[model samples]
Target: MSVKSIVAIVVSLIILVAGVSSVYVVDEREQAIVVKFGEPKRTVTTPGLHFKIPVMEQVIFLEKRILSLDVPPQEVLASDQRRILVDSFARYRIADPLKRYQAARTEVGAARLLEDAMESTVRQVLAKEPMNEIVSGQRAELMKKISDLTNQRALTFGLEVVDVRLKRVDLPRENSEAIFRRMETERQREAAEKRASGQRDAVKIRAAADRQVAEILAEAERQSQTIRGEADGQAVKIFADAYGRDEDFFEFYRTMQAYRKSLGKDDTRLVLSPDSEFFKLFMDNK
Candidate 1:
């Protein structure tokens, strides 16, 4: 080969290598950190082709996408000396790549630091709370406090904590069993008391109803007796007036009615004189 051609080929090869090393494509969801000899030089936030010194500068790409970190279940003791298991998660983003790179070189390291800070915050917050507050009802407030504290701690690391949430807060298995048993016992006792109260109310209502019914029946009976007595008195007065007009006929009629009522189908014998007043009805035709 000619000397000029050899020189041109070597220059072309060097240019190709430098071009390959200098050019970097920043993705839409990523930010690039330009570092010269392990020291941060600049940060590129825009997405496009970027350039740097061919041999000395390096580009470190960081994800700009929202991230989630799940903290493992941790046991914490409350102010009441009750142990609880808490499982939680966090959402965050990288706001400053330079600070993030300086503090946490890798995503793993950032996550670890966040976890440690979360653990400390959880312990500190829970240590002043009662068991019930930790296990129920106050989870939202606790999560907010954790997120705030975590955000404050992560500020130096260029991390923005968006949210922190507790998946579950529960008593240990043995404690849970005890609490369940107590709840069951309380419910049963309340049910029994309510049942007893219902029975008492039922008895009182029945007694009141019965008293009203008895009073109604007694009042009806008294009115019926009064009406019957008035009728009897009117009948007696009518009979007395009739008898006064015809004494002989009324006496004969009364004697006949008495004989009919006194005799029975099973009677074997009846004795009476032919001319007696009691036999007058039977002897009248004869």
Candidate 2:
């Protein structure tokens, strides 16, 4: 090849390289800023082919997509003076490319600043509420406050805060253990009190039952004694009438009853003279 042909070919390649470097494309998911000599010149949000001065102007592409950031868990103090472990996250987007580039050189840098803002905002907002509120249904309100504050702060970095969420909010391990133990102790105490009350009620019921049984038995015995006394009186009247009708027969009948009573048992024995009055009736019969 000729030397002139080689020189012309080299110049054409250099021109092509410079032209390609001067033009850059921005896509739907990207926003860009053109910086000349380390100074941002213009911000471009429209997605299309763009131009810049080769070797002097540089295009910094910033993501237009919603970015997610997970913040580290932090121990924060609640208004109730309770310590809580809170882990959170947020979604954001680059609203102004030029401001974003000027404020943070890279996405990583922006994320760091946003994370700090998120932590500070969350802590401040939570500090105004008690732990119960933060852990309960009212937590949604507190999170909104944090999100608003974070959005306001994020505006300075040309970032739009979309949403801030609490991934997990709970008591520290030590606090959790202490609370659980206390709850268990309280339940146990309540159970013991209930058992004692039941025992007292049972004792009262048993005593009442025993008293009722004793009254019933005493009344029954009184009725039985009354009936027996009435029978004895009736028997004595009949005996008097019989004795008036036939004194000798009645005397024999009474003596026979006495003999039966005396010898009712097989072991019966008596020491008496054959002519004794106790045996007079028996000797006459014999």
Candidate 3:
């Protein structure tokens, strides 16, 4: 091969390598920083293809989108001297890539600092509030206070504190157990009171029912007695009418009734002569 052709080919290869190395693409979700010897020169917030000095400058990409930091759960004491477990987290995005690289050097380092600040601020702010406020009364207010304080510290790390929240707030094991016992005792006392009230109501109902039964029986007896007296009076009137209509026939009917009454029983007996008054009527008939 000719020397001129060899030189041209070598130049083409070098240009290709330089072009490929100089060109870098920035993603939509990311930002880039131009660095030399670990020192940041400038930040590129826009996305798409970009150019850099080949073999002279390096590009460091940082997340442009919001990031999350899960602060480790820690036990904190409230202002009221109550201890609770707080699980919290934060959302943030790097506002200044140059500042972020200078302070934290990496995303992981930034997150660590932010988490530490969040945990510290949580303790500091929450410890000035009561347990009720921390748990529910002013939970949002307390978290906001923590977020503001943490953001103040996060400035050093070049991170913005978007939101801070507590996922759960709960009492200690011993407190929970004691509360449960007290609740159980309260429920048992309520049940006993209800049972006593029910028994009292039952006694009242039973007494009322018994009184009504006695009153009904008395009324039924009164009605029965009134009817019986009326029937007896009517029968007596019928007998008197028959007697007044015919004297001899009435006497005969009375005698027959007496005979029936005396002899109706199968074991009836009488030790008397044939001329006894009971048989006088028979003799007269004969």
Candidate 4:
């Protein structure tokens, strides 16, 4: 080969290598940290083709996506000296790539730092709360406090904590069993009381109803007797008035009825004058 041609080929090869090394593409969901010899140079937030000094600088890409870290369950003692198992989780985002690279340098390292800070914050906050507050209604407030404290500490490491939440707060197995037994006992007692109260109420209502029924029947019987007595009196007065209009006929009829009622087949003998008043009826009939 000619000397001029050899020189042109070598320059072309060097130019190709340098061109290949100078350009990099940052993805849409990623941020790049430019480091020169173990020292951060600049951070690139925009996503596009970027330029760097060939072979002299390095580009470190970090995910800008939201992240979730599930903290393992830990036993915490509350202010009431109650031991509880607390399982929590957190959400975070990488806000500053350069700061994140300097502090943690990897996602795993950042997660570990977050876990440590969360553990401390949880312990410090929960240690002041009562067991009931930790397990029941005050969980949201406590989680907010933990998130605020963790975020304040994590700012230096370029992590923005969005929220912290507790998955569960459980008592130990033995304590849980005891609580359940107590709850069951209380429920049974309440149920028994309710049943007894219902029975008493039913008995009272039934007795009242029975008394009312008896009073009604008694009133009905009294009214019936009064009506029957009034009817009998009115009938007797009517019969007396009717019989007064025909005294002679009434006397004759009464005499005949009395004879018929007193006479019997077994009475064979009698002593009486033929013209006596007692024989008047028989003589008239003959």
Q: Which one wins on TM-score?
A: 2
Candidate 1 lDDT tens digits, 1-286: 9999999999999999999999999999999899999999999999999899998999999999989999999999999999998888899999889999999999999889888888888888888899887776587888888899989998789888999988888888898899999999999999999999999999999999999999999999999999999999999999999999999999987887787776745664668677886776666574
Number of colliding residue pairs in each model = 0, 0, 0, 0
Q: In model 2, where is the ten-residue run with the lowest total lDDT?
A: 277-286
Give stretches of model 1 more than 4 Å off: 2-8, 36-42, 46-48, 53-56, 73-87, 126-144, 165-178, 212-233, 262-268, 281-286
Candidate 3 all-Cα RMSD: 4.1
Candidate 4 Cα misplacement greater than 4 A, ranges: 2-12, 27-29, 36-56, 70-88, 130-143, 165-184, 223-247, 252-286
lDDT of 4: 0.91
lDDT of each: 0.90, 0.92, 0.90, 0.91
- Best lDDT among the predictions, by candidate number: 2
lDDT of 2 by residue, 63-162 (tens): 8999999999999999999999999999999887777777889889999989999999998999988888888768778878989999999999888899
Expressed as tens digits, the lDDT of each residue in 216-266 for candidate 4 is: 999999999999999999988976886799988877877888777766557
Every model: Cα RMSD to truth: 4.0, 2.6, 4.1, 5.5
Better candidate number, 2 or 3, judged by lDDT: 2
Backbone clashes in candidate 2 total: 0
lDDT of 2: 0.92
Ranking by TM-score, best first? 2, 3, 1, 4
